[model samples]
Target: MDLQLTGRRAVVTGGSRGIGYAVGRALAAEGAAVALVARNARHVEEQAARLSSETGARVIGVAADTGDDASVAALAEAAVRGLGGVDILVNNAARTNPGSIPDDDLEAEINVKVRGYLRCVRAFAPAMVERGWGRVINIGGLAARQSGSVTGSIRNVAVAAMTKNLADELGPSGVNVTVVHPGATRTETMLDVAGRRAAASGTSREEAERRMAASVSIGRLVEPEEVASVVAFLASPLSVAINGDAVIAGGGTKGPIYY
Candidate 1:
């Protein structure tokens, strides 16, 4: 199916690696001009170059701290200058689960995932609204649906709430806002995590990964590229009917039924 993404301009935060990188690659492969944003200048640049070379798309890297307001403002300007004008915004830069973190850590996590997402939207969505077309795909986690990490659940749920509100506000202007929930996704980072789990449990990496995949009905962890395909669709004009929705890109969760 043609996603109709060619010539679109996109900015993907946390685009240096993992799911963000995969999303950037997918969009680029589909013929979009992309700007990859992350906190690390070098990593984003390297990845951007690699992606451009691989996909033959115009891809640039911009470094910015999403947790800071000034940084996000600067990111907005830079992305506009780099991509000409942003048509798609992928909010994916966020802190991972910090198990047993102190209560004070809650503010920090919320700032990064929740507030950070808002900041980016505030900075970029106006242009989309003016153009009467845009896509905002917020990368949340399955923790919002299932309870495990308190911080994870709170932040992701907050993101889902923000997505709905933004969708309502922007839908009339042709901007679709949505959240994507990825569960136990397999990426380079996940491979390292699985290896560490294997070492800690005296098991092979494959065994550890299998155990991690047990909860997924697919009987395997969802790959980053798999999630990217879903995001690519959401980032395209073809996804107009899915605004303000939470699309679970995770290999179906085993038990609960979500309407």
Candidate 2:
């Protein structure tokens, strides 16, 4: 299906690696000019160049810390200068969990995922409203549905709420806002995690990955590219009917009837 993304310009935060990178790649391959944003300047730039070469899309890299207002403003400026203007914004930068104390991590995680997403929207969405076309896809996590990490659930739920609010506010102006929830997906980071788990448990890497996917009904971790495919659809003009919704791209959690 034609996603109608040609000539579209997109900004994807946390785009250097993992699901963010996959999203950027998918959009670019679908004919959108893309700006890949991340905190690390050199790394994101290198990845952007590689993506451009691979897909032959006009892709560039911009560096910014989403948690900081000035940095996000700078990112918006850079994206405008690089990609002309962003028609799609993907908010994917966030603090990883399972390490810090849930109580202590709440504020920090919210700062990055919740507030950071708002900053990007504030900096970029007005222009989208002006142009009368835009897509904002916030990358949330499944913790909002299932509960294990307090910080994860709170921050992700906040993103979902934010998506609904933004969608209502911008829907009339031709902008769509949505949130995506991904479960234990397979990305480069997950490969590292699986290797570590294998080393720690004296098991094969494949075995570690199987253990990781045991809770998923598909019996496998969702690939980053698979999640990217969902976001790419949401980022396109064809996704108008899906605004303000939470699309779960995790390989289906085992026993949750989320209807």
What's the residue-level lDDT of 195 in candidate 1? 89
Colliding pairs, model 1: none
Q: What are the Cα lDDT values of the candidates? A: 0.93, 0.93
Q: lDDT tens digits, residues 30-118, model 2?
A: 99999999999999999999999999999999999999999998999999998888899999998654332367778888899999999
Clashes of 2: 0
Candidate 1: segments with Cα more than 4 A from true spot: 97-104
Root-mean-square deviation per candidate: 1.3, 1.3
Off by over 4 Å in 2: 97-101
